[model samples]
Target: MRKLLKILSREWFLAGMLLAVAIASAAPNLGRSGGLLHIDELSDWGIFTIFFLHGIGLSTEKLKQGFSRWPVHLIVQTFTFVLFPLLFIALDALIGRHLPPDLRLGFCYLCVLPSTVSSSVAMTSIARGNVAAAIFNATLSTLLGVVATPLLVRLLLGSSGAGISLGATMLNIATMLLLPFVIGQLLRPVFGKWFAHFKSTTNAIDRGVILLLVFGAFSNSVADGLWTRHGPGLIAMTLIGATVILAIVLGLTRTAAKLCGFSPEDEIATVFCGSKKTLASGVPMAKLLFGAHPALGVIVLPIMFYHQIQLFVCSILAQRYAARS
Candidate 1:
């Protein structure tokens, strides 16, 4: 019982997610209504701010050091961008007929997302891993994802009737995600100290923005009869699918780290960083990528589920690793 409570306390953000979903289900109109404070516009600006702060927090020196560890970086990047997506595609091929089209696409979307930044670093630190490498890889993955995610979606889901326009999607990502990240990096020299001083505030902003995105996406889903269109069975299947994917990725990353002769610290970093996906980036990307589609909410469900699952599982793994270290 104590262990369960500790786990829950550590993962309060997951509870917030549930609350967001419930509120959206009850009053989805709050997210959809347009006024001076439009939710869509707010979500857009929130995404920009999120990446901008991410930029401010990065250390160029650490990033360079992380780059120097080319072998580990390459492995993490390859798994995040290439291997994960192929695994999902294979999963889709095997079980695609059994699942709804939207859910299948959601699985693919979850695969393409970058490794999460804050959580990946936090878990790596907890596990006594190479924190600098975690930071660099996570940051670089987000930047790459701004381009790679959209392109991969176009290639993987274009024929699934998602109506993805590769050019328009790239334009949206570049303007909304990449441009702010670059501006933040440029301004970091001036505001870096201030950003560090208010680290807690920036962290809050990150969680707040994600919750807002969640509320908006789920509200849109609820408004579109998400519950009626898909029964509890499909929801269960998505949960199961997310769990299985995480397990497979975790096993593969650990095995790959061992075979590649990574140090224990580097191995832990690779396992935690490579196995996780970023809901922070995924939500905003979904809005830009699939906003017009009817199943936008459904499309992001797998990512949402996977985020919580990875946190819970990685928390346990981190604890174990720390004990060994």
Candidate 2:
């Protein structure tokens, strides 16, 4: 009983995520944009706060030391930007014609995204990996994502549908996400230490923003008959697809690290950072990029599904790596 309770307690956030989905599915009218809760307005402000908090949480000086670790960085970044996208591109070629358009684009978005900062670093620490390098690559991946994600989306999905304006989306991303991040960094001199003091509070706020976004996205989808349109099969396929992608990436990262003669610690960091995608960044970007495009929920599903899948798998891997260490 105690062991079961402990497991449940640890996964309460995941439970909350499931609860949010259920609520959104049942009461779609409440959380949908321009609905009773005014989620669209709240989400705009919430998006700003999320990026501002990211800026405050990050310290430039701390990541400088990892600059010397170029080989590891090369492998990690290549896997993130290059290899991941190629896999999805090939998948799109093979099965994309059969998949729903929004869902297919979701996979492309998933491929181009940067990794999760908090989870990647945390998992690396748990796995007894090189924490400094993990922190560096994760941060770099996100910052670069502002440009990389958009460019890759245009490259992959330009005429493929979704009517996205690449130029305008870039401006919105800058004005919405990047600009606030810059402002936050400037203020970080004073606010950084203060935020560091209440890390748990800030972390909660981040998760809170995610829940609100998730609720809003799923709510909009439900109102539009997302489930009625596709049914349960799509969700099942998303879970299976997310699991397969994570497993393949995890295996390849570990193998590549070994081939390059990396230490066991480096391999741990490589696999965890290389395999994961960022819900934190992906959610906001989707909101910015898709914008009430009808398929908003469908577009975010891959990362949403991938995010939880990676967390579950990485936790076990982290434990195993810790044991070996």
Candidate 3:
């Protein structure tokens, strides 16, 4: 019991996410209803603040130092951008007809997403890995995803009759994601010290924003009658699929890191960073990408489940790595 409590304390964010999902399921009106503050508007601001704080937390010098290890960066990016999507595409080809169309698309969307920023860094730190390299690679993945995700969706899902407009999707990403990130980066020089001084506070805000985003997303999903469409059997299949994808990616990353002769720290960073997909980024991107598609909620469901699975699984792996270290 004490051990479980300790694990729970370490993974409070995961608990918060589950609670958020429950609340969204039970009382979605809280997030879906508009009054003084609309959930959509709040989520928009939360995303902006999340990225802005991310910018403030970054150190330019450390980023440059991390960049010097190009081989590690190359491997991480290759797994994130290339290997992940291809794996999902192959899976879709085999079992695509078996699953609901939206869920299959969700799996594909999950693959194309970038590695998460804050969580990847946090997990790397927990594992006693190359923290600087994690930050650099995760950040770069986000920037690259703004363009790459749309293109990949077009190339892969174009035939599904999703009517994806590459130009409009790109515009949305630039406006909602890239623009805020750039603004945050520009302000970093002035606010970097203040941000560093209150690191814990900023980290709390990061988690809070993520929770808010999750709540709002699930609220939207519930409002659209997500449960009616996705029955127990479908949910179970999604869980199984997400787990398999994660296992494959984790194994591939570990093997690749070893083959590349990475130091233990770099190997840890590569494996953790390379295996993650950002629900924070993926949710909003889905909103923009699939705007008003009846299946938008369904499309993000895989990523939602995948996010929790990765966190729980990686937390255990991180703890094990820390013990060894």
Estimated TM-score for each candidate? 0.94, 0.95, 0.89
Q: lDDT tens string, model 2, 64-104? A: 97677788888998999999999998888888888888788
lDDT score for candidate 3 against the true structure: 0.84
Cα RMSDs of all predictions?
A: 2.5, 1.8, 2.6
In model 1, what is the error at residue 242, expressed in angstroms? 0.5
Q: What is the lDDT of candidate 1?
A: 0.87
- Whichever of 1 and 3 has more TM-score, that candidate is 1
What is model 3's C-alpha RMSD?
Answer: 2.6
**Model 1 spans with C-alpha error above 4 angstroms:** 1-11, 33-37
- Which sequence of candidate numbers ranks them by lDDT, best first? 2, 1, 3
Per-residue lDDT value at 320 in model 1: 95
lDDT over C-alpha atoms for residue 50 of model 3: 72
User: In candidate 3, what are the lDDT values of residues 204-254, reduced to their tens digit?
Assistant: 887887777667766777777877767678779889999999999999999
Tell me the RMSD of model 1 versus the true structure: 2.5
